[model samples]
Target: MTTTGTTSKQREQATRKTGSQSGQPIVAGVRSDLHTMLLPMFAEQNEIHDLETVIDGCRIRIRSHDAGVRIPTFMDQKIMMLLAAHIRDVIQSGGQPTRHINIDRREVIDLIGGGGSTGGSDYRRVTERLQRLHSTKITAETAISADVSRRRHFSWIDAFEEDILHTDKGKEVIGLKISLSVDAFRWITQGDGFDMTRERFKSITSAQSSCSRIYAICLANLIYAKGEDVYIQIEDLRLRVPSADTLKGFKKRPLSKAIELISASPDMSRYLSVSLVRKTEDGFIPLDGRAPLESVYIRVCKGPDALPSINKLLPLSETGGDTRSLSAAESLVELLTDRGSSAFTDTEMADMS
Candidate 1:
């Protein structure tokens, strides 16, 4: 694996050069299936021994390698997103991307919007989050089509090494050298992925509240709905999104707060609209205007501008005509839609909030 680093001067120069470019920021592609199924949007303090849940038809199992290590949190997911953006840049530059990547600590700080300084707290935060990502295990089993089913076992980071230098300055922490698991690498580089603007990504990741971060990701992935509404059971959502709150608490506070934030943000609302609803024998009813909190589902509808262009759907390849590209696109749609399992009647759409 090749290790790379940059001094503060070099970083400044790179930043200036990036700014001088055509003003179009790089777009990162995150694997649709993994984002929706494997990654949890909320943070957790308690150690997770073994967690198993089924989303759509896919069965997911998560475990921590050590008793002390916790599952990857929303912050960890941000790091993964940054890494994915870097990999995309590499591929676009005609460079062969690898699982082992070296990222400067300063770069990570910038991504997380932790300001320019790489203070002790920032250093520890980056290193500890990388360690947690390295220690967690994830296995997902889902059908690709009517006939094909696949099971994959992988971690976010297969290995992590911190670059430290000792000299007249005593000791200097350089950066991080991490090896992404093979599955993770493929997911970013080859799988059916969706494009997210770097600006939008930064906005969501840098939010103060974890709920806002979680809601943004959930809403962003709903672009696959193609301007249609997606109704997910509240219980099912609680299962996928790791939260400390009970189901009732989740519905009352975190979920509501998230809805408020997303609704208020122009960047988020430009692409999707969200609401809470109750499913009944006749149809779905919008829970609005002081309605009592009850068992309800989240209804996410894509906005007019939410669909991706043809170019965004394909992976960054030299020829841009790889056979796997089509399969990837198809797989993404299949996995996210739950293969019709979550489908509802048009009557469920009346008086949508």
Candidate 2:
């Protein structure tokens, strides 16, 4: 699927706007447990099977009909944001989920951060996406007690209707209403998920890969759910990426690459403090171990004040306006040293250097 330049820009702009709003309602909080909702970057072209992952502690597994696991693309994710934001708004207003949520076609476009009138190619695209979202299936389970547990199965939406109206401006699908599946409604209202802020959403949308987006979201979920800095094992991060189990799916090297991308991005680091460390049975292991890199760790930084020292280290590169061999290693060493035990050791530092 080759997305045209126009379509790609639209996606990026919509994502950027999500995090720009002020104190907005639920911009669509994906259920944290639905870890594999979005398909991986490399495998987006293929059909996904029974994708599964364990987010936090709950296990979430998804199986689609013959339609195959609909890997929620960037645009599809925006649709989710709209649904999530609407549900969040409804809940905050002390209103409950009705049988159907009616939205003006123009309103829908605005909600999704798109401009221009809602007609032509834009309307068709939005309509098709809503249908696709409705058809995707998922099953989520979490333990209730030592002997009790709960299971939920449903699609992202149950059904949708396009309300056509003939107005002076000509015929148009002025209104669009989507019926929420019971499970989707329940999860939106009662389940646990990250309350994505405009800034956080912007960061996630701006990320370059499936793993990078997953890493950022998981980190946000941890902070939101725990109300403090959280530590997630590297294995947990690896599992979050859909189709990442086999070598063809995803591997440790790609996982390392993903973590590295997050660490390198200034925008991502603003909302979440990310770092990669090695740990073994004996506790924190030296990076020099011939043992392959096991996992990456992530944490959400609490305040803007936490950034200055780390920011200062970037200037140490002294590249003299050259593009290649910018002494990234030297800067990394300084950055890690500043971060203390939370970053790599001398051996790891040399390896990176």
**In model 2, which residue pairs have backbone atoms overlapping below 3 Å?**
19-198, 26-85, 28-84, 28-85
Off by more than 4 A, model 2: 1-61, 66-75, 94-99, 104-119, 140-152, 165-171, 193-200, 209-212, 224-229, 245-254, 264-267, 285-290, 293-353
State which candidate has the highest lDDT: 1
Would you list the C-alpha lDDT of every candidate in the order shown?
A: 0.61, 0.47
lDDT of 1 by residue, 277-320 (tens): 87766667887655444447778777657455423322545324
lDDT score of model 2? 0.47
**TM-score between model 1 and native:** 0.73
lDDT of 2 by residue, 20-81 (tens): 22123333432222222322212232355456665544456655464643544444656554
- Where's the lowest-lDDT run of ten residues in candidate 2? 307-316
lDDT of 1 at 312: 31
